[model samples]
Target: MKSTLRSELYKALTNKMLYIAIAIGLAFWAMDVMENQEKIKFFDETLQWAVNSGLPIGTGHEGYSLFFLWSGLAPQTKGANLFYTVWPVFAAMAYGWSYSDERRSGVYNQIAARTSAMRYYISKYIAVFVSGGLAVAVPVLLGLLANAMFVPYAQVVQGLGAVTNINFLSELYYTAPWAYGLIWCGVTFLCGGTAACLCFVVGTSLRYSVMVILTPYAMFVAIDALTNSLRASILKNVRLILSPLRLVWSSPGWANPEWWVFLMLALLTIFSFGIGYWQVVKHELA
Candidate 1:
């Protein structure tokens, strides 16, 4: 078990696709930051002008904070949209297709000679989390770091858009901005891992690597299509059930994304792991 787990971890970490996915994610982050450059400059100029004019700056008056500058939390720019919109691609792109590839290449059978198939599958399942989570989370972390250097570390002020926009974790945003950032980082990791595993499950059932890679994104779009129609309706209460894409987003596009909606993804992760285990170990499908 330990050897299989170690082998899986090594493969996951060393996959060229993992770095490719990370680079793609960073590209999205870079575009987001670039598109928001004008806003950043405006805020910077505003703060400088206020300081130069001897204007009393307080709370709502000042805007150069980590929250406002960070690519994920910035206001009004859909710059992060490109990143968040295709996050599933980033998630699964890292290593989700490994199972499908290995199975197709006869590597699974080769490895099965030394270890139980169950252990191999389980180790790959666990390895998926490390690669997928890092692929998605690292870009956000880097964005936070870049923004932190760009601006002074100011707590999210009540009057700012950043504070007001925090719908799910408002308390942490108010009290500990650091915690807010960390929690979001954790959320992104979990979501990415779950998404990758969903694709991993698809790989168990399907032959094509592309199909496995796109399974999560396809399902996400399908769900979004259904829920978006509800947004057109007058039932404000219904909007609380955001699609997985919006659920993972820091700032939900429409109605408030409840923390409870994330449970669906948790359920999905367990289901995929369960079904994959059943197919490979019990049924010997793979």
Candidate 2:
């Protein structure tokens, strides 16, 4: 199991698709950074801007920490919007579709001749999960570091947490901003992993490579649309958004992002693993 996992991870991490996802995610992050040139300019000429712009010099708005990330002051940045909109594609793009190829091409038979099919499938799942998680997580971490280079970690205001749409975990954002940021990173990782796992299942049936890769993104968009429609039509009081895509955005979203998200993600991951294991080991081995 250890050897199988290590081998699969090597291929997954070194895969060109992983890098492509990272590059795409970072490009969106860069768009936000570029769009915020006015704020960056404020950093350069705070004294000059305070006089003319009429905005407070350092009221935590000019460049609060994590400003360039999806969760920062620029909640509706065009690039960030685009990035989150298609993040599931990035997740699944990493290593999710490989399983379909291996199964169809009979590579699994060769692999199973040496190691058990159970070990091979388990390793593949881990590789997909890690690569998928990294595809999204790396860009967010890099975005934070990049934003840190230009902006200071201005303490998130306690009273303004709700005002800024950080209400769900507003206390965490208010007390320890860095921890709050890390929590979002964790969220991104889990969401990405689950998205990829679901795509892996879809890949079982999809023959077209492009559609196999795109399965997760389509599902996220469809589910998010359904959730929105349901919320508007019937479940008006329920503030918790069901779509993971919506949860990826930090600000101006989820006034009550319930604790159940972690539960849902956990169950989804288990279901994917269980189904894959059952399909491969029980039926294929038989």
Candidate 3:
């Protein structure tokens, strides 16, 4: 299993798609930051109010500022919400080609002969998960770092109040911004990795790289549209589960989700992996 994992990792590293995924993620982040600069500046200007209210302005506030910046920028326009609209596509592209590329290059047959189908499938799944997660996480982390460098750090106070979302306004973000950032990044990783695996499942049978890669993004859009059209609060909340952006941002009202939300994400990933594994095992490599 270890050897298989290493071999799969090597293949993922060498694949140009991995780099392309990272590049796309970064490009979206760059565009989001540029588009949202005014919001960041406005937040900075509000620091005087915080100062008047006896708030501390220092490095401790950097994380909170960045968190606030992200929250504000993320929901302003659909285009700014890269976590939902763009990350999944990049993630799908990152691993969508895994099986098809291997099949076309004849590596699938060679690897299949040397290992059990289950082991090969599992190894590739792990590789895809890691590669996809990093592709999404790295760009967001870079954006966070940039915020720390450019945005003024101002402590949270009653006057400045909290960001609308509990996740950003929570004590966790105020007292320990780095840890908060880590948690957000972790959620991003899970969303991206799971999205990639779901694409892989489609790729196993679809055979077309473009369809495999774009399917996840299309599904997200459909869900978003459906949820928007729904009038019931319960259905809207349920649909939030399907939204990677909401999951990561911990959007207003749904912020500080119950443990079941995380469990749902885990189960979804496992279910996708199980389906992909089953399909690959039953597939004819001829």
Candidate 4:
């Protein structure tokens, strides 16, 4: 297992696709920052006005608050939408080709001769999850760091009262800003890793690199559309479970930090891995 993991890790580190994923993430952050420059400027102006008027800067709009440094880069935010939309693709690039490339190059036969299918699959799974997670997390963290350089590092107090609609996770945003930011990064990593693994699993059969890579993104869009259509129904919870946006954004009516949300995510990850393992074991390596 160690050898397999090391080999997989070496491949991941050397993969040009990994660099492409990172580039995509950084590009999204850059675009988002550029688009939200007006908002940042307004925030600076508001702070200046507060100082001139002898009023506390905390009285300004929530949009200008320090919390925006992190929240502004969330998947649901306008500037960050590009990142959210293409994350699955980034994830797909991270691991979708792990098996397909091997199969195509006849490397799987050599690896199969040395290790059990289960060990090989498990190693690839871990590598895919870790690499994919990093691919998604790093760029968002960079964006947050960039945003923080411009915004004041103030507490998110003034924004609390405005949140008349409660999201169970809202307290963290106000009382524990760091944790809130970490949670967003964590979710991005988890979702990105899962998407990559799912694509890799699909690639076990499909073998078509493009189709495998796009599968996760297509599923994400389909789920988003379906959930939006069912917004008024009780199935909204289902929508939340399926939508990565829910993990990043504090929706008006939904109860976030809900145990069920994590539970659902965990189950999805396990199910994807389980299916991938089964596929690998049954597959006839060429």
RMSD of each: 3.0, 3.1, 4.5, 3.2
lDDT measured at residue 162 in model 1 versus the true structure, 0 to 100: 48
Instruction: Please report how far candidate 2 places residue 244 from its true position, in Å.
Output: 1.8
Instruction: Compare the candidates by lDDT and give the number of the best one.
Output: 1
| TM-scores vs. true structure, each candidate | 0.86, 0.87, 0.80, 0.85
Candidate 2, after superposition: displacement of residue 211 in Å? 1.2
Candidate 1 clash pair list: none
Candidate 2 residue lDDT tens string, 1-286: 9999999999999989999999999998887667555465656576566758886655455233443233442255677777777889999999888898788888888998899988898899989999999998888777766667655556655554432443446567666777777777877787788888876566357777678888878877888898888888788887665776665655545553436667668877987787787788888843
Q: What is the C-alpha local distance difference test score of candidate 4?
A: 0.69
List lDDT for all candidates, in order.
0.75, 0.73, 0.66, 0.69
TM-score of candidate 4 on Cα atoms, chains taken together = 0.85
**lDDT of model 1, residue 48:** 84
RMSD, candidate 4, Å? 3.2
In model 3, the Cα lDDT at residue 230 comes to 67
Q: Cα lDDT for residue 142, model 2?
A: 74
Query: Model 2, poorest ten-residue lDDT window?
Result: 65-74
- Better-scoring candidate (lDDT), 2 or 3: 2
lDDT accuracy of residue 228 in candidate 3? 58
Question: Who is ahead in TM-score, 1 or 3?
Answer: 1
